[model samples]
Target: MTKQIFKPRGQNTTRAIAANVFSLCFPLFLVDAVRRVHPVALQQFHLLPPDGADLAPGLLEDDPRIVIASAWIDLTDGPVVLHLPHTHGRHFDLTLIDTAGEPFASLGTRTDNDDGVDVAVVGPRWSGEVPHTHLARRAPSDACWAVSRIHAHSPLDRPEAEAVSRNQHVSSLGRRAEHRTDHVTSLEPPAVSSLRQVIELGPAVFFHRLDSVLDRAPIGFERSVRPLIDQFRRDLDGPPPVSSWSPDLAEALELGFADGLAAIRAATAAISESRGIGWHAVAVPQHDESGASLAQAGRAYSSLGAPAREELLTLVCEHDGHGRPLRGDRSSRLRFPPDGLPPVRGFWRLHTRPTASGDKRHGIGDRNDLSPDDDGALSLIIHDLPPAPGDLGNWLSAPHGEMCLIMRLYAPRGEALSGAWRMPPIEIVDLDVDGSRPGGASSESLKPNRRTPS
Candidate 1:
């Protein structure tokens, strides 16, 4: 007797459409997740002051030792050349972010240009001869962002670093780029944007924007995804077409959008479990294929423009060793054992958020003038007040209300990149037995996890 095979009815009908629609919207949700973080104006290269004075909310990683010249770039027309004046002997790194909000390329002391040089960034669609003197880099996405970091060696070097950073400029290929309004961009509000808004835009708008951006710098993915994305592109676009499917299926679209968002959020929460003591570190994967997977999009949404692990490892501490949340109203101490400095070829910088008082403190890693204990351990007192009359650099300011610390390990290799080197816990000090007061270890502090900056 032959067995009968049962096939589901209308497998290629509404059910299939719904699944494809769901699949299409999930990744787009991640893309916009990256984009909403693209807050701040399209203003080119705004210089963040070393003291972090009048800081706006949502600054990811900032400090007194570095000056950042940040700007939003568009490659809709063609390739654009990023220009940096001669650095002479200053350490600098310029990171370019793609549409997915991932740092696709970096140029400066770590990669190339020990001194300085012109670098032309060409997208997938652009084809032209870059000037022989300029280094040409092929980018994965047309919509990009530029974040240039210049290190300030000392009090005397800040002004020079700021000047050098401000001198950087980007020139479009061919004729002067006449700004085109049709160029694709994220939700760029004068203020920072959240993920909810982007998700709310739903499948229609998100897919449209994705198509426009990919037109300039298309990233090819695997069979399962590439075909669906292309099908939607073709169906929604035409000379004479049934592309406008929104009005007819408005109700279905809304319901699907709501259900998809709820499902994705629940799944994401289960995935982002607390993994470390008090520090939360997110590293961009080495080969994150564009338009290929969910992890790449998720990384961009969480860490935004963070560089790859080989170049930098950013760690954030919002609490202390006792599982107590960090509060800005109190004080704390970050102690490092002798030979404890993160062993990296380039350098390491510790950033304290909302603590403007200790902006003038000396080098965080200048061991020559450091005052260490007999055990060779170094402890840096963090408070809103200044250190003693003639004490060598050890005081980091605490904010009046809230706080957190950001540590960047540049050129991380060996133990630092591996799980071997652990982050030193922040000692919550200057509190009473009941968690109130100032002076000594009280066991309470304001080091919220790395995200929004006050």
Candidate 2:
């Protein structure tokens, strides 16, 4: 035959190589797509204040706290769509507190069923007579729309059924009002508009409605989102110039992606390890006359860089002769003059728990009985056995050999970071013996505990 056919050489090999490259590039494309779409989706439904109203603070820190006095959520429509964009699996804790920060009263559960325990509603009054309402106490979901200011004493219908029936009622009212003969007759229910307002506004609107009650914005979104804006700007404009896309740039892109993935994995691991594991303390002794200046200490600590940073628990002991370096002991009690208290800002909380070793002979109170100082500083005694009347504040029942103290500073003020704020050291004041109390060992007399660089 006259025709010679030429078969391409390395066809399978070329195809295999192409497939591998595609596999690598495909994930990059997907990640970029996700990143682009996610922010857009979040922004689309971001809650905004009503026409002339001011924006409320978003959630702050991990634990979002808000104070609401009184407000009405107007769902102008009968049915509302509450979109919980950020809340994937977590439930919401919707609680109403009195002006004095006390729980108003027990309202029925927000969700009809107890399938989710994250979201809940607390009001002055909630009874079982209301339709589709549960009295069980639990949390609510991210997205929940409900009729606010419902007369707690009034017999209610099932929440879901009522929500539906309320829609019908509104429609009936509109029709009746259209044909009303007497101007004196009231054709519509008084609470209907308020309930409808909630339905029409959706989740974003509902959040804003609650924010109006406080005359402030939601705190969560502000903290989380504002940081990202700065980060994005820095990424786009700061430092080295961003390179343009090219076939030759693929290698660099892949390497950068690998580095980012590694960072994400490291962060995830660190978060997992730190949860409820106990406290970490970082102490930097001051030398200058101005004890308020943190410049020297801050620079010194920052020079050591991120690894040396310590997550402050709380200030246990301040200016007492309790000593420079604290001695380790088994007792849970602490004795200090009120004047030498550590400087704290915002809110501070203390927790007492047994050491990891699970020894019950130590002194420290369990979670229930932490006594705060006269100024809201936590003051309690530590002892193996229960303390006498004089040592009432000293009962810290910890394990026998060793224990720890955790101090949480929420919304720390500038002094906390600046050298201006100094946390007093925790000194071991006493330990329990065979049916008697013994004074605390001195830091010098006690065995030297190794000081790890924080």
Candidate 3:
């Protein structure tokens, strides 16, 4: 017997199963590799008024008025330029922040006669950090107009060498300060700076990887990728606060390579946990034209479009407790409801901040400013000021025109999403002169109410 020859029966079956799995998941791996290598490269530079430039005084630690100009980037091998004007006759600080609102770098300069400073940044390459140059104004001017030009170059190309030569030209712009602010009125430069040569490879890679992952991943896994990508972009291109670290090239390089990765990871976690259910609705009361009590308002308006129909208002019933919707409170701006709102064993709050145009600003407002009713229900009024004494609990100030409401529900029970836990509908009610509802007409009888200054 020539060494009994035998073949395994299940070998082919095992191989086939493995091949199928690999075929489904190979694209995701390729995409992930690309995404990891092609990170978002951003450079945002802007000028800000000095500490005491405004007559009303500088912004406090929490005020949103301190920002002047900002920019963002999401890819490498490109150049970005900003021409910042110095109109207030004061020296301005030029600052740059990555997407995480972390400071990247800064260049301080003085200007007179309105001639601003010029800043140029080069993205990283295979070599060490790319060299950047800053040219200080030759002479002082009343108002400085700074021009920024950013460039992105391919690592494969002679990016480092070319950047050096291009930087020389950028440096030359500061050689003479005699030119007036109107000297270069043309918004379009004759040629784009070399830094702009780099391409935004991160966005392309991110999408490609996302497509691959979705093909083989569970719905939750697939859904989480977007927030991660968004966070990556944001960390790479948002504004830093004033108290942040001073902007320097070394700091930016470190943040770009390190903190950027951290942001991506955090975003991935958030996306993974998100259930993908966007908005849900709860039941409330409906009213008739004569202000008579009618039927109950159900979940139909949950997805309805705004400027809501007459006799109907849809309040966001479920949200992460961050803030409540209120009308006249200024301190409630820039708050996010606590994450995940539902009817549970926790407390809830809601508030609203009036936009300049009377709409709600994105992602602002939380529970700290809302007043609760006698029965423990949260009340909100959309008027511009505190309602008369009795109605204070429900009065929220509305801008003169259109407005939005933000509500927060905290520690909501797990049953909230399934409708097992129900919250009373947010009713729109009319306030009498003394701020109390007359005749108890209910929320439906509330006419178009006004609470702002005459």
Candidate 4:
């Protein structure tokens, strides 16, 4: 005779139900974000080169070193092929992202050579044979995104970057090829401004969009979680119980979304203090402490819900090391001690921007005319004053009001990726100190050569 195993329901069952609800909805959150911007299509590419005065393509935190080629992709009908042109030793990457904004595959200098590659991106259900000469990658979801970045060292490099971008192409199996478009347009809606607006989306509106995307894309979630997804569908489709009102189910839906947002915030907050001094470093574990490993939700939330770690490693500072808000009222020094520079094959940059409004201030880094001191230490002085005689190579413009400083390391070294190295502290310099300056006069009268940190 066969025996059946059963366990009694525990007090944590409701909480488990709530957590499962969050995982189901998390991936759809980003999918809805894309829909809020553009109408659904098989493929569309934005081919404009970044002018440093405008936003890049799909996301925020753009840099001047790389020009972006972005597109929203759909592979429900057949396989999609991304055609990468030969970059001739320039650094570039074509990152393939899933519905949840987690990178599933990469084609670039790090993975493939700069000679360029033609990659055939297939969906989970695709079984047809791909060409032998082309690289083959299976995407987890039918709906995905591709961001292609080409290195542009300076204003003079824009022409070459544009030529390389113009040659790249994208096509589906047995279809006419689609090229990049030149016009610039805004696809993102104005209503979705901040993170709070995303979290505050009501359940019915949010889930309705989520359910629609799941209908088209098969993300191939783990087998254990499939039942919970089915339950969510049933809860939405089936009628409310005889004793319950329709509004009650809506309340539960809102509660689940709130719970998911809270969980994400808590996970990010737990790791916020690991970076020392006044900087916030970005990091995430490949697996949890239990060794069970993390799936899409954990990876998606790791960089505070960014696409991937390979995209960029960032350090943010709202205040100086001395706990003063970063402003032009007082000068600040960002000193790189001996052997403290970022280890990367690509490059590093530092710039400033306001948290609430206005464009980012003028940036500076190794890409510019920066040079080390006699002891091989690199120092950058930030203020609104004109560049002094000796300060021509190290002066960075800081907006006169409150602002933030960001350090971005492109193609960071393994040490940075593994969290083995930390950035040095940014020292605050007081211009009014005695004996520190040549004449010890007020900050307004001080020349660049006369200013020194205490």
TM-score per candidate, chains pooled: 0.68, 0.28, 0.26, 0.77
Residue pairs with backbone atoms closer than 3 Å in model 4 (clashes): none
- lDDT, candidate 4, equals 0.59
Best by lDDT: 4
Error in Å for residue 343 of model 2: 3.7
CA shift of 336, model 3, Å: 21
After aligning candidate 4 to the native by TM-score, how far in Å is the CA of 62 from where it should be? 4.7
lDDT of 1: 0.56
lDDT of 2 by residue, 352-387 (tens): 333323223222322235444445444454333344
Winner on TM-score (1 vs 3): 1
Candidate 4 lDDT, 368-396, residue by residue in tens: 78867567777777766544655657777
lDDT of 1 by residue, 1-454 (tens): 1111111134223223433444334444444444434444453455644432112112344555567665666676678777676676677777776554456678778775857787788876788798898888877666666767787776578778777776776667644433332332222332424344455576556555655434433354332355655554454342123265655454544554555455444444434436445776754533445353334434433544445566777777877788776665566677777788777778776757655553665325542365665567766666555444333255565566666777778877689877688778887664444463223322333222233323
CA deviation > 4 Å runs, candidate 2: 1-329, 332-337, 342-347, 353-385, 399-404, 410-414, 417-419, 429-454
List the candidates ranked by lDDT, beginning with the highest. Answer: 4, 1, 3, 2
Task: Please list the C-alpha lDDT of all candidates, in the order they appear.
Answer: 0.56, 0.27, 0.29, 0.59
Error of 1 at 111 (Å): 2.7
* Segments of candidate 3 deviating more than 4 angstroms: 1-347, 352-378, 400-404, 430-454
Which stretch of 10 consecutive residues in model 1 shows the poorest summed lDDT? 1-10
Candidate ordering by TM-score (highest first): 4, 1, 2, 3
